[model samples]
Structures are given as structure tokens and as C-alpha cells.
Target: MSLSPILDLAGLTLEVNHLARGVRFYSQVLGLELARHDEAAGVAEFVVNPHQTLTLWQPITRQANDERLAPLRPRGASHLHYAWQVEPSDLEPSKGLLDAHGLEWQEINLGTEDRPDWTLYFFDPFGHGLELRGVDRADARQPHFAPTPVQRPPHALPVMGLREVALAFSDYPTMKERLPRAYGFALAKEQEDRDFAQFTLGPHPEPDGNGTPRRWLYAWDPQVGLADMLGGDHALVRFYADVDAVGALVVAAGLPCLRDDHGLAVRDPEGHVFEFIAG
Candidate 1:
């Protein structure tokens, strides 16, 4: 029997070194509105939209007090790479915003034949890499998935919200079957590469109406991950939807469960760890 999709992507978490510096980069530099911060817990949360949230937690070793936050390990910063969506018209302003702040950014195309999207890449103070994306995909690929409504504060900042999260896996064939079966993430698009294919899940129209839909992408590359340069195949994701059912599915699948402090932390069949937090 196929399991229902448990996570609605309520939020994504990031591990940073310094709390103050990390806050500065995300809040001041990137312009993400500061939603809440618990200094006692050494965590600062940002509002991505009214629904999906982003969090930065300073590992206990990095912050004061030994008993800090749950799922806390001295794992350094998040090497997990992901992209954020911005308005197509705000693309120039986004670039200008980065340039104005003296933050170095690089641009590249992440689109199909007709739809060419220009994405800007930059790193936060904690070395967590991020992208500001905009696209004009005249020929929309795959079935159209409507974006969930998120009444966020405003698009006043270059950083908008999280979408695609790239993780590493060794077996695509096995994962391709088990992932959707376990999580209900549809196989949206598959772009072939030299070694492995880029498989996207739960892809939809850009939340802001541009760029390739948020990539829930996974590629089989064991070489580079989040440990080095924050390019790891691991990610901690939150489930705003069916939390209990998802956790049960992880056990039923016989995949490894690493930690479950604040949520159900489990590895895929390929051994990529993701924290399934219930928001």
C-alpha cells in the first residue's frame, strides 16, 4: 500500500556557528524578516511565508549552556544547498540588492529549453549557500501543480521562500520507487546528467509566479555533500501536514532512523538524513 505524503514543508532548518553573525546575514543582509528568536535556546526563526518558515539554530557547542536545542550536534553549518524564489520583475532589484550590500553573487540558468531562469548564488555568513531565482518558462514542463497559498509579509527582500532541496542518494532506481511510495511526492521532472538523473518531487508552479517550481530534487552523487562547503545530501525538513503517518512510514520502510529529539529524524533508503518536524 502507498503511504500518504506527510510533510507540507512547514519549514527548513539551518545549523549555524555564531548566533549573532548568522542572524545578521539572514535578517540584515539577505533581508529575511526576523520572526522570533529564543536566545535561551540559541535559535532564531525567520518567516519565509505565512506558512513555511526557516530556522537557524546555533549548535550547543557553538552557543552557551551544554543543554541547548534538540537535534543539536556539532555538525557545523548546513552544507545542504537549496533555492529560494523571487518575483521575475524583482530579479534586477534582487541583483542590485546583493551588489549594494557588497555581497558577491554568481548567476546561472536553471531552466528548460524555452524557459530560461536566471539564478543568483551566494553564501551566508555561516557559509550556507543559497540562491535567488527568477524564470520565464514559456513551455512549462510536467503537469502544473498549483502553489500553496502563503500570505507572507511582503516581497520587500531578495530572499523570498524555500522550495527545492537537493539531496544525495546512491540508488535512484530504488529511491525513485520508494520515495514517492513512502512520501507521496510525485515524480515531476527528470533531467539526465552524466552519472545520475535529477529527480524532482512535489514540484509546482513558482509560488511567486516565476522560475522553475521549487525543486524537491535528489541526485545520486556521493562525492560532494553538506560536510564540505555545506554541500551535503542531508536536510532537516518540517511536516506541517500529517506528521504521525510519515513517521510510521519511515519505520515500515526499514530505513535508518538516526535521531528523534524534536521530530522523527530518519534516513532515506539511500541513507540521507532528514528531520521530519511537526509544525
Candidate 2:
């Protein structure tokens, strides 16, 4: 059993300059179903999977007038890097889709010869970095979260849901220490050369099978290679977890915890917002 209260990444909200353009790219090109759109509020929500959401927000100047929303307003990072998990078979089709849209894409193999883990990297219309990761599975790994029935769009890229989200940190060491202490994250991988680290939350099974944790949180210095591409300073990253435990931990670690209608939230040193939602 995992001691961490965080179960999974619940949603991600990105800041976009043009809401319509963002919506068209995600819905028409990526095939994510648009769940809700509030034109007046300048927000669009897309169903990434049964349990996850991808939201686009166009910041309004008058948002400060609404006290309840001002704090919760989606001010996310620009050129943020996030990934979606796909089946190995879907990779080629994804390439075709990108090419058809005249979008430039790059592919990299992260796994070995016998088992290949391929990642296709591309950008959205707004320049947010996006990735499609596919791995050949000889043995099926047990899922950490229970399967929920969802109606996927026929033209969608067969995305399994969010695989990872990366955050650019101005002070990587401080943020790194606080995450494990406050959120019960265990360091899974470290690329010191790149000044990046991957952290895993909740119970992970082992060398193979059910022990492998699929979801990841990647933290890297903003000065690093791909991190430099991130234009915005902050983003709203949310997770499904025990709100009480998360709140307590945040306070104990000397981090400021803010609570509103959206549960508990804390800002990292770089101003990136982390919100915890009760499952």
C-alpha cells in the first residue's frame, strides 16, 4: 500500500491567448471531446479520459473583480510539456495525423531493442509542448487506478490518459525536497546532467508487472534544454488525493496552503500552482 494520499493526476489547465484556436486544435486535431465551453468566462474543458480533464483558459483582465474566481483563475504556463499515453500501434497513425496537419514532429526511442518505448513530440497551435508515448507490452502491467467506462471519440488517437506533466522550476533543489516531504513522492529517476528528476506517487509494484508506476511528475530547471522553451512562469496542476492529508503536509512543510471552493492549493517557489482534490 502507498502512504501517499495522491491517487492520480486529475486535470491540467493551460493558459491560452485564443480560446477558439486552442479548442479547435484539441478537438479537431487531437480529437479530445469538448466537455464544456464557457465563452464569457473564456474557458474550455476537454475530456482527456473518464477520470482526467484538459482545460484551456484565456485570462480576462476583469477576473480580479470576482474574488472567488480570482484565486482559482487558470493562469498556466506557456509552452508547457505534458504527455499522453498511447498504444504502440497508434504511434504510426499519430505521425500521419501530425503530418496531415502540417505539424512538425520528432520521435525518440527510450526503451531497448526487445521492447521499444517510443515518444512522439510535437507542439500545439499555441506552442505548448505535447507528447505521445507508446510502449510494446509483452506483459501487461496492473493499473493503479480502477478502469472507468468512457466513450472515446472515434477519430481520437487512442490516448490512455495523461502519462506525465513536466514543470520548470527556478529553484529545482528546493522544490524537489518539498515535493517528497509534503506529497509523499518517491524519486524514481534522476537525470543530473539535464537537471531533471522524475517522482512517483502512491504504491508501485516492483521490477515488473504491477509494481511499475505509469504516471510521473517531472521537475527540471528552467535553464535546461527543453525547459527553456516554456514561455509562461506558472501553471495550474491538479491531482486526485486526500485533501486533508495534503493540506496538513503542506502546512507542516512551511508552505502556504490556500483553500477555496477548489480544495487546497499551494504555490511552488516558481509560482506554479498545485491543487489537491478529494477523491
Candidate 3:
């Protein structure tokens, strides 16, 4: 039997040093509703779809002699790169909304002038990179990944569902080679601009017997690998699985896997953690 990890990218959880600031950006700026927030607990959830959500959390409380904190490193410090996909037409309106708020933003085109799909990028108060990618409504573009209009708070734009997220790495071959070995993700699409490689977790048996996630993981090397340009680590990925099968396969793969109160999880070569929760 051909083996796959039986994974999915249901949602992402980002860590912010300043929980209040993060919550403000995602709510007041992004226009996502504040579904639930517990400031005392330092965690908040934003609804995207009934199934998809964005969570902002703070570092777990530090204990005495926490091994998680290295000699010189800060406790639970994380830098992440994240993106939300939206329809092409929303681009100009979204830009206008951001400008109206006096937020600094910039655009970078990933395609030709006549065939542009631009990405608008900015940052949160603590420096976590945030992106909004516009995928044109062309037949060649996977409609499944194209984001549709989402319900938003009266304060912000109609931020849609996630379509693509990019990770920057120092070595292409290492990531390209390890992705399949560590997990079942493999190259699914290519960019004509030669800026990045797209990997995906194909449809698998949804653990809950419901809709599976349609998502993409992009790896950008060398040209954009500069530390100041991209971020990694502290990004969340939810994978639904046949627990028995995944547990056995994880042990068999022996690829730095871990478990917690949630479920099994494994990180990509770049230290970006993926949390495998129940389908």
C-alpha cells in the first residue's frame, strides 16, 4: 500500500509576545471577529469559517529551570510567517481599508504585469510577518484554494480563508528532500517566477468523515531566504488522522515526533511545528 501521513492543514495558531496588540491587529485591522478571548489566559480565537479559525496565544508560563528556554534565548519567543488568501477583486479595496487605518503596507507582484497576483504584506506589533495573497479567478488556478468572501467585523476588511503560506529556508535541497520523508507532503504546484516551491497534503480519509482541508505549504529559498525577509517556527498546522495508523507510522518514521494533550505532531525541517489533532 502506498503510504501517506493522513494530514490536513485545518487552521493556524500564532504566538505573540503581546497578546493585546496581536488581538487588535487581527480584529480591528484584519476585521476578523473576536469569537472568544481570554486575556488573563493569553489566548484568543478568530473565526474564519465554521471549520477554519485563527488563534493568537502567548507563551506558556515559564517554570523554574525550564529546559525549553536556552541559556541565551528568550522564553517561548517565536517568529512566524502567515498568509490569508482572497479573491483578486478584493485587492484594491483591502489596500484602501489598510491605508484608511494608517497601517504601513506594501505590494509585491508574483506574476507579470498583465497577469499579476500580488501579495500585500505587513507586520504585527511584535514583528510576526503577515501576508494577504490574491489568487486570480483563472481556470488554471485551483478553485479549491481560491478564497471566497468571509464575514468580517464591522471594523475591518472581508479577510478570507487561507490559501497559501510561505516559509523561507537556507537550503532548498534539504527541505525538498525531507518533506516527503518526515511527512507525506510533496510538490503540488510550481511558480513561474521561480521564487518558491509549493507542497501539499493530498485529500486523505477525514478522521471525522467530513470535508478535508485544501491547503498549500510554500518553501522559498536563497533568493528570499534572508532572515529579515521571511519567518519560520511557531506556526500551527492541524492534521486529522486515523490515530492508530498515524501513531504507528510516526514511530516507524522516527522523525522527531512528539505528543501532548492534543495529538501527535512533527515539525518540518525548519522547526515550524505542526499539531496533528483529531479529524
Q: Highest TM-score: give the candidate number.
A: 2
Cα shift from native, residue 21, model 2 (Å): 0.6
Regions of model 3 farther than 4 Å from truth: 1-8, 60-77, 136-146, 168-172, 189-196, 203-214, 221-228, 240-248, 256-262, 267-270
Q: TM-score for every candidate vs. truth?
A: 0.71, 0.86, 0.74
- What is the descending lDDT order? 2, 3, 1
- The count of backbone overlaps in candidate 2 is 2
Q: In model 2, where do residues sit more than 4 Å from their true spots?
A: 64-69, 72-74, 135-143, 146-155, 204-213, 224-232, 260-262
Each prediction's whole-model lDDT (CA): 0.56, 0.71, 0.60
State residue 2's C-alpha deviation in candidate 1, in Å.
Answer: 6.2
**True lDDT of residue 262, candidate 3:** 62
- Steric collisions counted per model: 6, 2, 0
**Across residues 1-279, which tens digit of lDDT does each residue of candidate 2 receive?**
446777677788888899999998888777888998887888899988777899998878866312443554437567788887776677888888788778889887666677666678888878788888763343344335533324446555566678678888877778778887876665666774777877664444223212133666777887534422452358878887778888888888876567867788887657777888777
The numbered model that scores best in lDDT is 2
In model 2, pairs of residues that clash are 205-211, 206-211
For residues 140-164, what per-residue lDDT tens digits would candidate 3 score against the true structure? 3332334457777655866677654
Task: State the weakest 10-residue window (summed lDDT) of model 1.
Answer: 65-74
